[model samples]
Target: MTDSSAAPLRGGAVGIVTATLAVAAHGMAGGGWADGSALALLIVVSIGIGAMTALPERSTVLLLPALMAGQLLAHIALSLGAAEMHNHSLLPSTAMIAFHAAASVIAGLMIAAAERLYGPITSIVRAVLALLTPLPDGSAVGRVSMSVAVPSVDGTALDWVISRRGPPVSVY
Candidate 1:
């Protein structure tokens, strides 16, 4: 069975890269890359959450930690650079790093919850579309006509264990 979650995972990765580039561009233009790095980390975390919603639940476990690590690394680099350039103390930088890491982890958990619900949400949408579609006989559809793929082993595996096509219902 072809994994349906692949598309969302790829999309999320792309989104992260795009957001990072956008942050870099803004930092360069404003000459505040170091100061803006905190904001950039937050933005990246938010974007990652949005993308993770479309991914499979199991993937979130790995992805979230990876994202957090990336954010941590970025935060450290930015903090050190800013401290060196401005000859500032490390106390404030340490505090900011802690905040960013905590925030990123919280965002990851939210994304995981969203990802867990994605399949059911998509199923409901498909069901609604089936009901809304008009029939030649002027009857409303009762069920999804397409083959529904059920994810196996919790939300981690997208292996289609059952493929069932509902009764044929004509739609105009």
Candidate 2:
């Protein structure tokens, strides 16, 4: 079994939190706090996914694809509805649905582009490392140098993205 002791939950937790914040911010843009409630479930699922990866028997190799797929669908949905969103609007329901459909396609493509740019190798490595490291709690240097991302990590850390495996057991 991999060293479960070393697989801290903070990184995945942070990812969930940040993702939730972003989602909430998007929802709040539409003038509602109700969407943020979904974030609690997101945090739980994120941590559970990470912890499952760290377990002794099963590997989390399969988890990433499903997680990625679900998130892709969600963001696609968000981007779709958000495109047609306005603080105040009285457009016809048909127009709104049509707009949302177009937007969903675009957002889905955006996620697809992100997946292609990052590639499976990069994505899997990051997922594994996120499961095994103090991802959310780190020094500035560590944050800048030793992190993972898809499209980006922090807003400014895009160029510093990682594309390698997790740290060796001895390094931990």
The parts of candidate 2 lying over 4 Å away from their true place are 8-35, 69-172
Each candidate structure's count of clashing pairs: 0, 0
Model 1 alpha-carbon drift over 4 Å, by segment = 1-58, 76-92, 134-172
TM-score of each: 0.45, 0.27
lDDT of 2 by residue, 26-96 (tens): 34445233244344544455455445443444333333443443343334444534444435433323433
Task: Write candidate 1's Cα lDDT for 1-172 as tens digits.
Answer: 2235654754475346434633353244332455555556546554664465445453554655665555555544444555445443433355444554555566556555655666788889989988998556645578547887776557557546456778899897
lDDT score for residue 36 of model 2: 45
| All models, RMSD in angstroms | 19.4, 23.7
Q: Can you list the residue pairs that collide in candidate 1?
A: none
Among all windows of 10 consecutive residues in model 1, the one with the lowest summed lDDT is 22-31
